[model samples]
Target: MRLERTRREPEAGMAVRTQLPAPPAWMRWLPALFVAALLLVEPFTPVDWPVSFALITVPLLAAFTQGPLGVAAVTVFAVLFEGVLAGTPCCAGRSVGYLWERHYVASYVCTILVGAIGTVLAAHRTRRERTLADVRFVAEIAQRVLLRPVPHRIGNLLLESLYLSAAAEARIGGDLYEAVPTSYGVRLLIGDVRGKGLLAVETAATLLGAFREAAHDEPDLPSLADRVEVSMGRRAMLLGGGEVGERFVTAVFAEIPTEGHLVRIVNCGHPPPLLIRSDEVSELDRGRSAPPLNLGVLVGEPYSVDVYDFRPGDQLLLYTDGITETRDPHGVFYPLLERLRSWGPLPPRELLEQLHGDLMAYSHNGLQDDIAALTACLLADQPAEPAPPSDGAGGSSGAP
Candidate 1:
């Protein structure tokens, strides 16, 4: 079944912002102006000094900041200037045929050789940049499809999410999350695959696909979890290639009822969700847990849903192990609960912003794994504002 009435963040294709402003207009022609100045000074310079050598700088600079055509233009200007100097009475004091003089001939030949090399280098640089741009486009499309943006509001809940991949080159990793509104309630899933790279990404996509489809049809949290587990088993068999037995996912699947102050959770070997109220932070459940999904064969017992009191004004925090396991130079793990005490009940968006900055600082920007965090806050007594219109991207959806 298709998700209904979902709004997602719009994709921005290839728009990159820079901290530095564009160079001033005068800078564009500075190289040509400098070459002209050198040509003018050649006549006045001491006979021992060859000012024509300075003209080489024009083509070298143009190669880095301009295309091959610009470099060729500079090279042509240098050649014409040399010819003028050879024929000028005040300069070389010889006719245009002085271009055949041994010294003048050597200078002209060296200039052409340098310009030719610069042109080839400029062409190669341009091709490499275009290739990188194409790769970035593909990565962005994949990211938008796999980890769709969570809306700012879903039903009566205000939501905020953050995702960071440790591999700076690849903006996507195995961490995953999805929140869908369903006839039963609003169902959510936050998970991390067993490993990294393409295999981990494949497993993550499979789990989310299963959760999105089964979330609405299943009557309860446990049934939904079972359906996902079955789906994962099939994927593991098809993709795992003898390592199927080793694949698994650590996740927390939850349900927030449409008109109640209760939130049910089933932790499948993932970190427990945190409950944050004004100046208070508590772990939702530490009593029991199910095996990581796809490894249900190892656990004889069935998964159990732990129900918690989710009063209005309280925020529920779900995350992958990347947060708790982040270590400092001293090898001590991050103190997540201690830090939350100081945040003082901020809105979901602000809370995540503060947490991400603090986490990066604590780890000294050396995160070793992918991190994904989702915060959901139940609205206060006042009625929630209607959700903004969808960008028509069709993100996951459910019932009010």
Candidate 2:
């Protein structure tokens, strides 16, 4: 078996898209229209009721939709409008100064103060939004580096994976998965760190890095698991800082041979994988299970590898606890096995797509934990036929 370690880079110079939609044309002219209407009515209204107080709405609206400079311009217009209205002829043919009584002066002062405060608020909001955008971009890059995309096809098996972070705004969390084609077979790892945030992310990165390197050097599943445990222990020592209850990771590792009908798995305090056949779905539970990595010191015995049949037309699903532990509004846990029974046999991609949609619908789109799922379909042992080479012109390249 040969290992394919390929990294795909994103297209260069992609632009960031803004989430807030552009303000409507009518909204852009709303402040001007409002001020004009107030001016037209000022001659008819009584001078005792200062109309300038209503002018504050212009800057208030601008604060929500426009930048600081735009809000400042609106504030200046409001103050000028109030001053002009005070001097204009009004009730009983009174002079402009007649409108500037004690109450009128107080109202005029309040309007100017309110507009200034609105401009400052708009500036502060814009700065906060920009900072959030920058942080989100960094989090996305970190997620991509830690959990590289799994290829659609690995060796003879078709693969599919899905990851959903509970923190929708951040778009990333501690859940992780990696599939590597090793000399022994195609080894896979799906794991979840015990906690959330950066600490969990660091532990997940440490686990995946160790798995990718050790999968090739270790002779068997048990030894490979040992390597990961050792790596996690070292990482915990650096991260724990003498804390008593440090973080740990629960994982399920599996190996599918190049030309075999058996799959070997090691369950390290993680949920058991589901084996789906023609008309049956069963959990691949073992008699013995080991403690999660970084907590191996608590166990007296070594990890046990469980073997199960993974024949043609069969699909195996590996997932983190987030899937089974999800609860609906009524506190009902998700019925993974019951739901899979109706899906019948499907391609890895379609199966995951349907499952993800159903899961969201079941939870009303409010999942409390980060979820990671990997599905592997065992294709025929014989190699697939190669397609004909394409002519140089932009013709069809044939089926993949």
Candidate 3:
């Protein structure tokens, strides 16, 4: 009997305005501090030397953190303060009669000119910042749609996902992941496209759409992988034009049975998933390698499914090459396996949080490639003498 798949309504949430945040408090007050410091020091300077001229820098400094109006206000204050210092008899022994001296007039005029220039700079900076913020906001929305957030719980499996783009301002890239709970089991997909930019992102979307739909319709893991491969081939041919060979995806597809102690995985030129059992980590490398999606046409190799023990309390991590290829200042690659060994057992969410922080620190917050990672930990126990439940005809409920 085929189970009717229900369509899920698109998630709706508050559309936050991700505008640039206000400047830091200290930065905002820096111009004020500069004026105060000049006021405090002018009294000690020689009578022949006047430090009030330095007030011109105050408006310039304000340009960095304030809008044009604020900069203009600072400029006016600076011009007025200059007159006060020049006429003050107690400071620098200057007389009130000389407040509007020709030199002081020139200083005021020059300060006004500098302030005008600073105001223009502040306006330009403000416009560019707003434009950048708008671009980022759109990128964030695209990320939500392309790489939708993975649910923390899927059946008896607890999942956590993390993605980082090489471009600092980018939220979505070639890296992609998706998890869907189907009659077959909880199916997961993670992959990275070969190249970068819009083409890579489009390819990733194609693979994700194919996986999400096929995971439910295809009964078996290998068959599902085959469907995805075919979809990728078509997408690449359409997008690549004459360069179809350049478009390929390194991916890993996994299925955890709804009632079993094993997981089936099909890796297509992707880094093998890591299995963590009782403080020990090992790679689930298949003896025979399979070509990446879209390359099957050229390589003419069949996809292979490998079954591995994934009982309750076991955690499996699937990641892209970006995590392993990260390099430090010393030119040494990140040691993922070595690092996982050192950490104690943690929940999937905490484990990924630690990995993200550690990876950023190891690379000094500099990543040269897009990264995607998914961790799944089994949370339910298998019944003793477990057997696949029958659907109706006494046949096993599990997919062939």
- Model 1 weakest 10-residue run by lDDT: 1-10
Q: Which 10 residues in a row give candidate 2 its minimum summed lDDT? A: 1-10
> Which lDDT tens digits does candidate 2 get at residues 169-199?
6556678888999889899999988888777
Q: After the best TM-score superposition of candidate 1, give how far the Cα of residue 349 lies from its true spot, in angstroms.
A: 1.2
Q: After superposition, how far is residue 91 of candidate 2 from its true place, in Å?
A: 12
The number of the candidate with the highest TM-score is: 3
Query: What are the TM-scores, per candidate, against the unseen true structure?
Result: 0.77, 0.78, 0.90
Compared with the true structure, the alpha-carbon lDDT of candidate 3 equals: 0.85
- Alpha carbon deviation, residue 107, candidate 3 (Å): 1.1
Which ranges in model 3 have alpha carbons more than 4 Å from their true place? 1-11, 95-97, 382-400
Please, what is the whole-model Cα lDDT of each candidate in the order they appear? 0.81, 0.81, 0.85
Off by over 4 Å in 2: 1-52, 76-109, 381-400
Candidate 3 least-lDDT 10 residues: 1-10
Which prediction has the highest lDDT against the true structure? 3
Estimate, for each residue in 70-132, the C-alpha lDDT of model 3 and write its tens digit: 999999999998998887788876554358888888899999999999999999989988997
| Candidate 1 error regions (>4 Å) | 1-61, 77-107, 327-333, 363-365, 383-400
Q: Which residue pairs show collisions in model 1? A: 181-398, 181-399, 182-398, 182-399
